[model samples]
Target: MGLLPLNYRRPSYVAGSPRTMSDDQISVGSGGSGGSGSANGSNPPKPTKLATVVAGIPDALGFDRIIDGGTCPPCTTRDFMNYLIYVERSAENLQFFMWYRDYVKRFNEAKTSDIALAPEWTQAMEDDAVTRIQREQADKIRKETKTPAIAIFNGTDFEKRREVPKAPGSDTNPFSSPPQTPNDRDGSSDYVSTGEQSYRAQANEAFAAAGVKAPFTIQPFRKEMDRVIATYITDGAPRQLNLSDREQKVVLHALAYTTHPSALREVNKLAESTLRRQAHPNFIRWSICNGNTARVIFARVLGGSLIVVSTAIALALTLSSLGRGYRAVAAIGWVLGIATLIAAWKGMCVVLHGMHHHHVRPWELFVSEEDADDLGKRSFDSFGSANSYEEEPWVVRYHKRNLIRKIFDREVWIQEPALRQIQDTIFLQSMLCALLIAGLLTAIFVASPKGNFF
Candidate 1:
């Protein structure tokens, strides 16, 4: 109930729609903006914003017959341009949902150059080249550059002279524009993309020489991407990520030597090999939140609850269809609908998604053994635990650290601690709200309003 009002005044509502209002007390009209409990000018829904986001694409959300083949289909620059426009529009306009439906409709009907690559299969295709290059090009690079032999495998990240990044189709290799053969001339020492371990090590060395360690994620995300991509290709294909019977039977069902060694090492010590290898029951829809994969299971629970409540109200109205009060009952659905819409908008559904993935399920806290790739070594203890504050709270920790450091170093620091006080004020306001809601619900029956409109 408080969700609708609480999430109402948001500066930016990016995830979905806001929480719906109570069907019993509020009236959300048909006018645009869905009657968002706002008294200002009405604004329509922003569907395009929701659509552009790659997360939680509806199972029904896909092209009916997208082309796949020898020549890698180049995504239409125009369609991508439109998507960018929609993204920008959705970011600015409140009524962007009106435009969202049109964009999706355009996609299904129009030919888009932007091909949908299964996120899981990307690693395999990349590292295949890594291996290919290690065999064919590694020797050539060392002799030409006179530098240490730095092999660029079909690994995840590689520097491409091409403007658009991503693997070319098996037949349409993007490497052909100005083919990188073993015999190409020397003088180009910086051939590596920033994704490689050697590249980063070099970058870090340069930073150290300049007297600083750039605040960067020590995680070998590029290598991880490479490993995962390679596995997916071996497990299934570039077009679809559905693992084969063998892979599902073997890899998906059990734990093994994979991308995450440190985590596996710790978990293996705690659980038996059989249990450790058991498929993660809740891996169905987990995604990274600040580098930590947080499942949006809470939204599902809340969405389900709203649905049950709405169904009951709808049933009650049908039963009273012949009664004089039928009019009031008929409006009940609109009330419930608006309420659910509001809740969905407020990221309540996202919370439910989180809950579903974490509830009653034991999952691995380690990275998979995909580190078997030749390009690099996996960082130990990279994955953060489920309950660690090192996730989103890092921003706060940074502020706190800098604050204490200022006092310790005898430097004048006034910004962050003063900002912390403002945050505390907002926290107090939220506490007051919780109390107000409890008091209102408890006292509603005692203080009946004089017979008003009814």
Candidate 2:
């Protein structure tokens, strides 16, 4: 919500009224001075601001018809102009959405001259050029004359020779005017009149009808105007974004678990390829243990009890006959025995569970086939669907030298249901391996008391 207090506002541009007048009749120009003074007082009624005009346009003209392109034919000059105004206004409100902000930034910078509304020559731009020429002429006159000019010396000759800057469109092309392009198959060409003159004419009519002087200057916003027209031609709507099919899926499905719109808003924070690269390694061995929770807990308790019992027996032997010489070995045995108990308690298997003999049954660990399958699908869709024929560049797909760096650096994670699978599979495997090694060492110590029983 905005900080400002809310008050009621109304549209100023009333249509089909006595105030509407032709450009020749409208006296207000760029000079910011006098308005068509009202009879009631010397002060004229204030014209509507640009921001207010933008907000009120939907009420004046139906904005929905332009956005839903199929419902209407190709956009006209007025349609494109209104759409540009909408985008300019929308971009101002981008603080609330990061994805939209990024999209708008790219959309603004992208090359779009092809679809830009071909600007007709405007008297305003020419007048601006003439003003510049007049300034230059004054400078030249000052430089050329060594002495002060006599009363007979008139500057009429300099005025005739002064050069005006050409329009951006005409400067590039040799033709005096932009070449007329063929109309689209739909019979409406994409190019429309949007020069300063066109807006001045429209604004004059609207402001006159409303019985107020113009509030805003009608100036050329060439680049922004171009983007608006280009977007309408390509996307069929000014606000519509240019996202791919894969990106759309990621945006929608990646944040499905979270209820917050802010969480979903992060969908465009990274590239799709980056997400896929991170998801691939977590599914190296996708096997869901069809293990019952109770059975796994029981097995863990039984395994832990056995290791502890054995460790106790070894400690007793070391204290009685093995002597202080075996103290280090006994300490190692105790550490190993305790780690094995932890492994059993957690339903994790350190030995390769996918191997035939070492495979953990569903009853051995707390995992379900359905959960594994769903995770596998998400993993595959994220990265595994790449074409086999095209290899990723070595620079992008290369592995790190350090094991710790490899795991931490290459991974990109999102908060999702698949994270649970990562914890169960990858995390469990690592812990189980640590427990198995510890348990094996403890057993060896129990078997070899003299330290020479190789």
Give the winner by lDDT.
2
- Tens digit of lDDT per residue, candidate 1, span 140-206? 5556466433334322234222211332222242321322211112221212233444333332332
Query: What lDDT score is found at residue 35 in candidate 2?
Result: 25
TM-scores across all candidates?
Answer: 0.18, 0.21
**lDDT tens digits, residue span 1-454, model 2:** 1111122111222222112333333222121222221112211112111111122122212222222232221132222222222222222111112223333333233343422332222334334434554565577667657545531244454432332222133223243233332222223222234453443333333223222232222111222223322332122233333344233323222212111122223222222111111111111111122122443454456556655665676666654655444544544544444544444444433222223112222211233557545533432221112112123233233332244333222211222222233223433443455456665655665555553322
- In model 2, the clashing pairs are 19-208, 19-209, 20-209, 290-362, 291-362, 291-363, 350-432, 350-433
Clashes of 1: 56
Residue 188, candidate 2: C-alpha displacement in angstroms: 26
How far is 159's C-alpha from truth in model 1 (Å)? 14
